[model samples]
Target: MSHNVLITGGSGYLGGDLLARMGAANLPPYRKLYASVRTAEQADGVRQYGAEPLFFNLKDESEIRTTVIDREITVVFYLIDAVQYEPPLFFIQALSEVKKATGRTVHFLHTTGAKLFSSHADAPTDRPLLDTDPQLYEIQKSQNPKLNVAREGVRTNCAVVEQAEKYGVRGYVFVPCIVYGKSKGFGEPVSTLRQIYMIVRAAKTLGRVYRVDSARPEWPVCHIADNTAAYIELLRKILTDENPSHGKNGYYLASSGSIAWDDLYDAIAAALVKRGVIADGSVTLASEKNVEDMGTALGVPKEMVPVQLGGKCTLSARRAREELGWKPAYPAEHILEAADGEVEWVLEHLRD
Candidate 1:
């Protein structure tokens, strides 16, 4: 494997999983794997996964060009906001340099969340959302009051996929739903699991469970390991498929199953009772309108509530499975199966 791989956000929840999974595979995936970290502290953490941590800043296009083009990096994995046109379209410029230097197709994996279609709806959609689903899109052009957002994430994601050819890169946007389960990599799983952690912690601290006033919303979910498996298989395809039919036109979504918000709340409530976190076994449903302040209502920290809480946020990884041969081993119905371990872990690793 002469492919040099560069993974941005290597110390993040998803990026850590990618590095750890690649390292644990039967055969080493990349001949040279560089894990790009924003800080020196994260660089040390990435080294544990056998990846040479490069303190690379996406804002620094010249350095990125040197890394991707000069170092001949064939695969670039963006676990964070690499799709954004801001920071001066750094990724496109970097890949353009690669194509100018070498005519080879530089595989770029950009991650975007299912929140693109997430809404404040009361019910989940009957079917999973496709990449091209217009009704489900967050941005609606024709409505009286258009659903145009100022800083839309899906906009950047779409731009990368639509403009990849012009920039000389094979772009694939990975859109995953609410991700859970134990992370395989060394870095702490922060962003995706923060809500659940807060819920569990707040319940235990307050001795009561909480739910929102909104109608039960469905949330698409995938385990961390299963999500990582999808990435691994996608990379394998990028490496082996010389002229794959999928080409640069594929947008991959990873979703094992969908769980209703009420059900998840019950599961957490049950887990709390079983774990002795909540006494008297009572659940308290909260109102979003009544309490503008989460701290006043539940004593939980104000870390912007995830849109998945709004419901109808379902997605299908069917495209990814069919195209990349991705088969998620984790069960969506059994996501709370890891609740026990997660509870203990979060309690022990609780940080402000």
Candidate 2:
């Protein structure tokens, strides 16, 4: 018998891409694929990918109870917003509901990010992050509130894992870096890359060239396609009961390659220049006067300016590779190339 898979946030970017991939792979053909969305319009869009759309607000208790009970969903891909709801409350409630309804072993895939492991204090300049490293875990416990939330997320994830083992459900958690690639709907905002592109364009328009410094820290990036591939592989293992050790309720960092931020900036600039969006490469970082400006320009906090400017965000994906047999098709540079293609396509199609 085929299992039913329910993907929360299915109408969103990552969910839509995952649905598209599942359709293409045709692996473990789910008896039913249910996607949760907030609006009828979003549900309509999700149907384009051949998924049955379920409109439900994640915060509503009745909706949650109704959906989980009604669907009898055996496998759930919880890819909802990380920053929106309070982690402890949101997760506890959702997990409780799912656990109550599905008495059988349910597979829960919780999505997280590498930033959850990052140090808020003047970012690390030394080496790439590792999953088993005690130091990384220690740093995660340090001063940052966001990291603290991440710690709770780990706890919540582990709780589900333990519950799965005790109650015969299977649960796994995924930690990914900046996920980028092509998709049907607008994915997470590409604010940082777009800012870099704009700065390059401005410099080129003035006929001045500025070179990006290579000494800046490297940011670990993964193509959305490759990230989704890892997810699919993990899901397949769960469905077949092939290797319970795969993902195994532990944290796995998903990164394709680590490229210095300055190098990324230069690449975006180069792409802009190639498209005649700018004449030269003289670009600079945006002034940090307002919080929104910082978020809009860099996709991070204003306080993190120094750390980001210091540029040392690098992570290792050896765990993902060895355990999950996952490999990113595009490296960091190539992913940027794909992103540039996305931008070019946007400009070409949207422009007059």
Candidate number achieving the greatest lDDT relative to the actual structure: 1
Clashes (backbone N, CA, C under 3 Å), per candidate, total: 1, 5
How many clashes in candidate 1?
A: 1
* Model 1 segments more than 4 A misplaced: 27-30, 39-41, 82-84, 120-127, 132-151, 189-193, 201-207, 242-248, 289-291, 295-308
- Superposition TM-score, candidate 2 onto the true structure: 0.75
Query: Any idea what lDDT model 2 has?
Result: 0.58
Report the lDDT tens digits of candidate 2 across residue range 1-352: 3467788766566776787778676576567878887777877877777778887767776667567666766777878744343432333344445657655455666776655444433235466666544454444434244444444544554454455555445556577676665554433323233334333333433333233333455667787788888888777776775654522425566777776666656666667678776766544644444323543444455554443333345557766677667777887778566656755644443311
lDDT of 1 at 283: 54
- What 10-residue stretch in candidate 2 is worst by lDDT? 186-195
lDDT of 1 at 224: 82
